[model samples]
Target: MYRLLLQNALRPSLQKRRMKDIWVWNGMRMTEVDRIMLGLRQRIKQLDENVVILEKEDDRNLYGAISLRIIELELAEILALLDTLNRTTSNYHHLIIETTAQLQDMMDTMVALVKFDKMQVIKKEHENQQIKKDLEKCKNEQKATLPPPTLSPGHCGLGQMVNVSGPKTYSLTAYGTSYSFGAWGRDVNPAPGNDKYWLVVLSSSNVYGHYVRQYSTLSTLLLGLGPTDTYISSSNPTTNTIQGPNMVMYGNALYYNCYYTLSICRFNMTTRTVSTVALPKDAGYNSKFPFGILGKSYDYTDIDFATDESSLYVIYATTGNFGNVVITKVETSTTPVLGETWYTSLYKATATNTFMVCGVLYATRYIDKETEQIFYSFDTKTNEERYDLKIHIRKMQPNIEYLNYDPRDHLLYVYSDAYIVTYEVMFQ
Candidate 1:
C-alpha cells in the first residue's frame, strides 16, 4: 500500500518532465526549420540583386545586340536555382507544420491530465477572470489617451473616404497620319470648363497642325473634327520649335516648353498671341543621358510644368544639383511669370512623372505592371514630405510616359505607350 501511494504522488512530476522534454524537442526542430528558411531568403535576395544589375546593364547599353544571348542563359540558370530552393523550402514548411501538430497534440494530452483536478480547474477560472479585468482596464486607458480626430471637407464618419469611380480603359488612335506623329501622339489636354470634354491633340512635331477632337464623357466616343471647325490653328511661330513632352492649359492660355531655349511659351487662346518666359538661371535643360538623343525629352532636363486647383507651377531640377527640385508658382494674370519659389531636396530622377495636387507636389515612380505606382508627396504648405498614403491603380502600363492630375474632377490622366488611361483619385 505504501509503494502504491508513493507511485501516485510521483506520477504528476513524471508527466511534467515528459511534457518539458517534448516542448524542448519541438523547439529544437522549429529553430532548425527557421534557420533554413532564413538562409533561403538570403539566397533569393542575392539573386534579385543580380537581376537588377543585369536589367540596368540592358537599359544602359545595347543588350539586344551584344549580351542578349548570354543574358538569356544566365536568367534561365537563376530561375532553375530559384525553383529548386522553393521546393526545398516547401518541404521544410510541411515538416514544420507536422511538427507543430505533434506539439499541439502533446499540449492537449497534458491539458487532459489536468482535467482530473477540480481544485486546479477552479484556480484557472479565477485567473482568467483577473486577466479579463486587466485587459478591459488597458482598453479604457488607451481610449482616454487617444487624441481627437481632425475633420476635413468631404469627409464624414470614423472611416476613410475613398473615391474609386473612374474610367478603367482609355482609347488612343492615330490623330493624323501615322508618319506625322510617332506611335504615340505628342501632347493631350482637356479644355478647361468645357462640358463637352473637348480634347486637344498635337502632333509629335509641334510645327504640324493641331487637332481638336471632342469625346463624350458619358459615351466615351471619340468625335473627329469637322472640316469647318478651325479651333486648332494651322500656323504658329513656335510650331516645330516648341520643346516639350509637357503642357498645361489654364483659363485661355496654353503654356508649353520652348525647344532649344531655356524658356516656356504661353499661347493666348482668345488673343492668339505667343509669349515666352525665361526660366531661372540655373534650371537644367536637355537630357543628360545618351538615350535623350532618341527623343525622350524628359530624360535630359527634367523640367516640368503642372497645375493645381488654384495655380500653375513649374518644377525643375537645377544643373549640378540634380537631386534638388525647385518649384516656382506661375502668375498668369498678364504674361507668364514666376511667383513664389520653393526648393525641396527630393531627387528629380527618381520620379517617372510629377504633378501638383492642391498645392502639394507628388512624384510617382513605376512599380511594375501588377502593382500600383509608388508616390511621394511634398506638401508646399508645411514643407513636409509624406509617403504613408495608399494609392492603387487597377491596371498599370509598363511605362507611364506622361501623367497629369485634373483637380476639377480628381482624375489622374496617364499617357502610356499608345494608350491614355485615366484613374479617379480618391482622397483619404
Candidate 2:
C-alpha cells in the first residue's frame, strides 16, 4: 500500500523528469535502480531476522546462500554507486571500466546465487505444502481411531501445537501504513457489552499509541466500516498511552506496556482510569532490551503482554536476567498484579515474538519475509523447555509488530505491517 501510494505520487514528477531530458529518458535507467534499491532496503532491514533463522537451522547450504546474498547486496550497492558517479574526468575512466566489469561479473554470479536461493525457498514451500496435505489426511485417519473418553476440550485442554496456517488477512488498518507498527485484535476477555474488535496504531513518532479504534465485529473490521468506538487512553502521549506493540484487550480494558517505563499499564475503558504495576528486578524498558534478532530490534518492545487459555502473562527481559525472557502471570480480574513468575533461558533480544498456549510459551524467529518458524518453547506447566519444535508460521510481512493468542477462538491475531491477520491454530 505504501509502495502503491508512493509510485502514484512519483508518476507525475517521474514523467516530467523523463520529458525534460532525452538523456534522462534513455540513459537514466538508474532511476529504476533506485526502485530496486527500495526493495533491497527492505531485505537489508531483515538481515537480523534472517541471521537468527539461519543460525538456528544450521543448514550449511542456507548458510552459504546467506553469505552469497550478503555479497550480492554489497556488490549491487557498489554497482549502483559506480553507475551514478559523476564522470568529471577520464583520468580514472579506464580503471573504472575495468573495476565495473569485474564487479558486474561478481554481481551476476551473486544474482545466480540469489535465484538459486529463491528456487530453494519455492521448492521447500512446495514440499511443506505436500507434507501438510499428507499430515492432514493422516491426522483425520488417526482421529478416527482415537477413543472418546475425554473431558471437554478448550484452550490448554483442547490441544497442543500441531500446525499453524494462513495469515488470513482480515483488514487494512483503520489508519493506513504510516502507522504500520501497531496492534489489533478482539478483546480476549471482553465484558459482555464490551465485545468489539479493537485496533491500536502508533501515532506521532510511531512509538506511543494513545488512541484505540474499535469495530463491532470481524465483518465490520474487514469491510472497512467506521469504528464504533474511538477512545484515547490519555490526552497526553507520554502519560497513559501504550509504549510498545505488545498489548491485549481484556475485561473492558486495554493492558499494555506503559510509556517510557518498565511497567505494565491497565487502562479501564469504563472509567477511563489507568493503573500500573512495576516489573520485578528492574526489567529493561524505553528501547532497552526488545524483540528482534540481531541489530534489527523493534523499538520499545521491552514489555510484551500475551494471553492464552488460562490467563494473561507478561513477557519481558530484565537487567538481572541479562536480557533473558522473563514470564510472569498477570492477574487481570482485579487491579493488575503480577503473579507466578517463570524464568527462561531464551534471550529476549533473540526472539522476534512470543505467545502463550496451555501454559506453554512459544517463541518465533524469521524463516524469511513470508514465513516465521516457532523454534523455541517453555512449558510453564512442568517448567520444561524445548528448542526443537519446528512449527512453521505463514506471514504476510516480515515484521510482526504485535502477536497474541486468543483463547476465545484459538486464533493468533497479528498486527504485521499495519495489516490485521489471524491464523488458525491446528491442535494435536
Candidate 3:
C-alpha cells in the first residue's frame, strides 16, 4: 500500500512531463506547416502570374486575328459593292446608247407618219417662206402628238392560267428515273432563232447539281442526243452552280438558286459571266420551308424561278412572312436585280409546285400520282389571290420535281421523276 501511494504521487509529475513534450512537438509541427504554406503560397502566386500572362497573350493574339478578319470581310464586301455599282453604271451607259438610237428611229417614224419625209415622198415646199411654215407646222404636230417611248419596250402579254391539258412527256433524259429530279425549259425570251433547250439533272442525292446540258434543238433533246454544250462546274454542291432543280432560262441567262447562298445566280451563257442577287434577309433556304404537304417535302427546292410575259420572278418563302410564298420580280438586263416584291397568302410548304403565267402566280398541289391540281393563284397586276382556280395538271409520274412556264412557247415545262413533260396553258 505504501509503494502504490508513492507510484501515484510520481504519476502527476510524469503526466506533466508528457504534456510539456506534446506541447513542444505541436509547436515544431506548426512551424513546419508555416514553412510549407509559405513555399506553396509563393508557388501559387507564380502560377497565377503565369496564368494571367498566358491569358493576356492569348487575348492579344485572338484580338489581332479577329480584328484582321473583320477588316478583311469589310474590304471584301466593299469590293463587291463597288463592283456591282460599276456594273450597274456600265449597264446604264448601254441603256443610254440604246435609248438614243430608239429616239432617232422614233423621230424618223413620226416624220414618215406625218407626211414629212424630208422632201422624199412628200411635195417639196415651193417658197422659202412656205418651207419655214411647213417646218413650223411639223414641229407643232410633233408637240401635239404623244412622245415616243424613251426605250422601245416589248409589249406586255398578261393573262391568268385558265386551263392546263395533257402531260406530253418529252423524250429528253437518259437518267431514266434514277436521277428522278431535274429542270428543263426553253428561254422565256429567246433572242431571234434560239432553239436551245436546257436540261439540268440533279445528283443521285437530289440535293444539288452542277452540270447543265444544252441541246441544240427540241429534236435533239427528244432524241436524247448528246448535248450541244455541257457545262460542268466544280463538282456537286458547289456555290454558284445549279443548286436546286428549279431554274429557268430567260434572256440568255440561266437564273437559278445558288448553293450556300440565299440569292439568285444569273449565269449568262453568251458571255459566260455570273451575277448574284441577294434575296430578302428573312428568306428561307437550305431545305427550310420547301414545297411540301403535311409529311412529304421537295428537298432543297425552296427557291423557284418562273417567267411571265416580260419579267422573271423568284418564288420563295420567308421567315418574316410566316413561311408563305413570296414572289419578287427580277430585272435581267445586265446583272439581275430585285424589281418588285409580291407576297401571297398561300403557304409555300403546302404547294407541290408553282409557276408564273402572264403576271399571275399559280400554286399547285399533289392530288394523286396521275394528277396534280392548281389550287391557288396570285395576280401580280392586281395584287389579288384566288383559290378556286382548281386547274388539274395531268401527270405521267407521281411527283413533279420542277415546273415552270415558258412564255416563249406558252407551255408548262415539267421535270417529273427523270422525265420532262410539257402542257399547253389555255388563257382566261
Candidate 4:
C-alpha cells in the first residue's frame, strides 16, 4: 500500500511535465500565427493604398483626354471661323476693287466723250471753213469757164438704169481639215520648230502596241515611231507594261502619262531611250478595271499632260476629288524632275478637256448644238479666272471629247467622236 501511493504521486508529476511542454509548444505556434496575421494586415493596407493611387491616376488621365478633345474641338471651330472670315474679307475686297475699277472706267469714258465732242466741234468748224473755200473756188471756176449746162434728168436716169445689178455677192472660204482621222487618235501635237509642219499623233492598238505616228503635215503621209513596248523598261518585271494615254513633245524628248504605273514616261527621239518619272503621292490611278475597259469608259484617271510656252506640266487630281486640280511643271533632261506646282480650285471633271494657252489654262464643255461653245480660262499670270468667254463653233456636234489649243497655229482644235474640227482664235 505504501509502494502504490508512491507510484500515484510519480504519475501526477509526469502528467504535469507533459502538460507544461504541450503548453510551451502551443504558445510558440500562436506567436507565429499572430506575426503572420499582422503581416497580412499590413499587405492589405498597402494594396488599398495602391488601388486608391491607381484610381486617382486613371481619373486624371481620363480628365486629361477629355480636356484635350475639348481643346481640339475648340481649335477646329476657331480654324473654320478664321477660314470663313478670310473668305468673306477676300470677297469683300474683290467687290470693292471691282467697283472702284468700274467707277474709274466710267469717269475715263466720260472724259473721253468730252474730248471726242470737243474734237468733233473743232473738226466741224474746220470742215465748214474748207467747204466755204471750196464753194468760193467753184464760183471762181464757174466764172472763169461758163458752167456747163446740167444734164437732163431723163438722160441721167437712162444712163443710171442701163445696168442696175445687185451688189456683188461674197462668200468666205472655210478653213479646216475635212478629213477625219479615225477615233483612236488620242493626242495630236505640232512638232517643235519644224518647217514641214510635223504632227505627232498618239495611237494605241493591242496588236501594234502604243505608238506614235509622225506626219509631215495633217495632210501628209504618216510615219510610225517606236511602239511603247520597245522603248519602255519596267522597273518591276512582274508589273504590267506601261502605256501612255497622253503625250507632249518638248524639244527632242516626248513626255507621256502612264496610268498603270502612275508615272511619266519620257522617250528621247535622239537617243531612243525611255525613262520614267514617278508621279506625286497624291496622284491617284484606278487599277480596278483593265486598261482597255477603263480607256473606253467614263471612269478615267484624272492625270493629263500639257505643254505651255515655257515648260511641260502635269495636271492631276485624286479619284472622286476631281474638283481640285494640282498642276506640276516637269523638267526633262537626263532625268525628269517635278518643278513648281500650282493648286487650283477649278473642277477638272466638269470639262471635256483642258489645254494651256500662253500659260493660261482653258477648259471647255459641250452645250447644245445651237448654243455657242463656252470656255473657262484660268490665267496663271494673274491667277484670275474668266468664265464668260463664248466661242462659236460651226456645225457643232453634240459631244466634243477633246479640245486642244495649238500654240503654233494659234488655233483651237476640237475632236468629236466622228470629226476633228479647228477654229481660229481671235483675241480682241
**By TM-score, who's the top model here?**
2
Would you list the rank order by lDDT, best first? Answer: 2, 3, 1, 4
Best by lDDT: 2
Off by over 4 Å in 1: 1-169, 174-202, 205-240, 288-301, 387-390
Error of 1 at 21 (Å): 95
What TM-score does candidate 3 get on C-alpha atoms?
0.62
- Sorted by TM-score (best first), the order is 2, 3, 1, 4
| lDDT per residue (tens digit) for residues 1-428 in model 2 | 32344346446644543343344345444454445445444543454354445456656575667665764565455345333432321224455588899999999999999999999999999999999997896466445323322311334566656667666665676576787788888888787777888888887677888877788888888777977655555454767777888889888789988877767888887787889888975788888888886658898888988988768899998888888999999988657988999999899988899998877888998768876878888878677787766667767777788889988888999988878899977775
Better of 2 and 4 by TM-score: 2
Please provide TM-scores, in order, for all candidate models, with all chains considered together: 0.52, 0.63, 0.62, 0.45
Better of 3 and 4 by TM-score: 3
- Candidate 1 TM-score over all chains jointly: 0.52
Give the distance in Å from residue 276's predicted Cα in candidate 1 to where it truly belongs. 1.4
lDDT of 3 by residue, 1-428 (tens): 32244336445543543453354356433444344334434543443444344445546466656544544454344345434434544454576679999999999999787775656443554566688996896465434322321211223543333467565555548667678888988887878887688888887488777767788888778777878654646677665777778899988888888887888998888777789989988999889979986689998889998987778889999988899999998988788889899888898999999987767788999988877888777778677777765567767878899999887678899998888889887653
Clashing pairs in 4: none
Cα lDDT, all candidates = 0.55, 0.75, 0.73, 0.48
Across residues 1-428, which tens digit of lDDT does each residue of candidate 4 receive? 32234236435533543453355356433443344334434543443444344445546465656544544454344345434434544454576689999999999999999999999999999999999996896455434323222211121112100110111111111112332221122223434554232222223321112333343444432222322223334332223233423345566566655535677777765576777888766575552221121124323435567765456777776544444666678886668888877777766555555667667676555555532234566656566666655443433455544445555655555544334556554332
